[model samples]
Target: MNKLTKSVLALAATTLSFGVFADVEREFSETYNFSSNGTVRVENINGNIKLEGWDRDQIQLEYTASADDKDDLERIEVEIDASSSHFSVDVEFKKKSSWFGGWNGSSGEVEFRLKVPHEVVLKMIDSVNGNVAISDVYGDIKAETVNGKVKIENAGSDVSVDTVNGDVKIVMQQFKGDQRIKSESVNGDIEVYLPENEGFRLDAETLNGDLSNDFGIEVEEGKYVGADMEGRYKSGNARLLFDTVNGDIEVRKD
Candidate 1:
């Protein structure tokens, strides 16, 4: 082949190789030493975060911070520190140094998935438009979201989930320690499913919907949109509190 033809072939091959090996995004991972009484705090603003509990004693974190321009993501950092007897994880945003500083007109997102020890407490705070899921944890959980949904499954301790405009669902076996469930939404419903013998200081109310329960408790006769019942189950232990502002409240025993 001639020199120009060979040069064209070489350029095409290099382009193909670059397409095959180049990464449009990057992943960041870090691990920190943890204690049994430590707490894992995950905070994010605009993406989904999933936390799974493991059987080890370490904090594992993985996240992908990406944007149209890589410089915008430079401001995103995950900070892990030992605070008192607990470990805290936070998503830190680097502030702009000057008037025209720090990704003022950039668009990107990051997704974080971590696996921490099951014995560590969890504190999750999502500011806006982020969903959170946690599973297989044996520690106390406190989760709050302003415009997102929160879901917990197979939890082994007390959990409190609150959302302003999203539905909350919790499915667990039991709360060996004292537990409390408080879910409130101005435009969403609250549903609680418990074992046949679960009990607590029961108080459920609704403002614009009906209330129905199947645990065989005595509700007072009143002029209300929901039932005003107060009694303890045979094996009541956890303190169950359920509320809904403009939706129905249901208690189903399995």
Candidate 2:
């Protein structure tokens, strides 16, 4: 073939490749409608998930997926289940990308950013690497990650979190609306800062870490090995439960 002819064919191939890449593999948006209450479940493989509470009645979800090959990116899927009082947002990636695409890094990674009403329950889980962040939410919050930090603030309800190797931090203004916090890490630490004169029960224990409490409890057995700490404060109402294996557990008044 002539030089000009060969160049024209190459240009056509490049354009086609780009066109394929630009095409929408899979894209859709869903909104859940409910009246009484709502719950959201989110799971991520190797990305960050952030949730924020809003005033609207609808639950909104958005995602961004990445893959090693263009074709693999098209196979990402999101499932939405809208119930009477609960909803779930699930992300699924193609399993056999290696056999079909023959790419080296066809694994999928998606990051989720969600905004729901303040009265909705939030449950999130991540496999490889993800960080959980919730702000201005009053409902129940439960999140777990393998290798990412967990941070929550301005919450008015109960909270539960578990991580493998990441620090967990919770900041609350007035924890009087039935608080139950259980956070643990084999390598990281747990820190909680709450208002002084809070009224609630405190059950804290640690096997390999030091336990510190500002409730004026005398030290015993080199740790606060107590079943419950109640009537020590007179303001805030909470039910705090903290435990860690290889990290420090701290509970202090603000």
Candidate 3:
């Protein structure tokens, strides 16, 4: 064989080898009968989780799992438990055993997209390494993450959000009931937007950050290197509390 031909064959083999071990993905989807006042919970480890409220009286769940190796993809498991009043989705990773009798690290990613009734309550939407987003929901919401952002838009009831390493943003269309709304972050900003005519008591503070408001409430400087805002906006029974350790807090009128 000629040298050029041998070099071409070598290059082709390398390319084929790469193609054999590329990332693999799998998709899963399901629909369930759910009530408008049901509760939904989702937990993820390494990808985004997005939930949107719809007019339908059911819940639709779709997720995609991807990994660099097919074996790793197989090790990732998704668990879903559902009923008429509640639904929960969880992602669990099965440990792989190494030749040395120890656990080998398996890596995979899962992105979940869910749609449910507009009046359902989001009890817990937690993620360890991905973002959590919800929109157009009319019930109470509670979401937290260890290393991702938490964002909610068009929320019609009370909300509570917490994050360790990302921002928290909540935009409410209407503040329902006298329930308290709270948001906290350890290393990212917190921003909340409410209707201009809504009445709420605001108590926002940050340890090493600044506070800004559009409701004409005064922001007081902390003793050290922080700021806080405490007062009532239109003097209502609703209460809002926001705090952060290393980021800014902004309260704006929608």
TM-score of each: 0.75, 0.74, 0.89
lDDT of 1 by residue, 1-254 (tens): 11111111111222211123332344666665666656777677667788888877777777765544444455555554553345555655454455776544434455778887887788654535677788888878888777777878777777777777777777766656567666666656666677765566677766676677787766554475545556677665677776667666677774
Residues 1-254 of candidate 3 have per-residue lDDT tens digits of 11111111112222211235597777777678888999998988899999999999899988878777778877777777787888888888788999999898788888999999999999999999999999998888999999999999988788889999999988887777796789989999998888998788999999999899999999999676888899998967889999899999998988
Better of 1 and 2 by TM-score: 1
lDDT of 3 at 80: 78
Instruction: Give the alpha carbon lDDT tens digit for every residue of 223-246 in model 2.
Output: 344332223455444777766666
lDDT for predicted candidate 1 compared with the true structure: 0.64
lDDT of 2 at 31: 54
Which residue pairs of candidate 2 clash? 197-235, 198-236, 199-236, 199-237
RMSD for each of the candidates:
11.1, 10.6, 11.1
lDDT of each: 0.64, 0.65, 0.85
lDDT preference between candidates 1 and 2, better one: 2
- Give the clash count for model 3: 0
All candidates in order of TM-score, best leading: 3, 1, 2
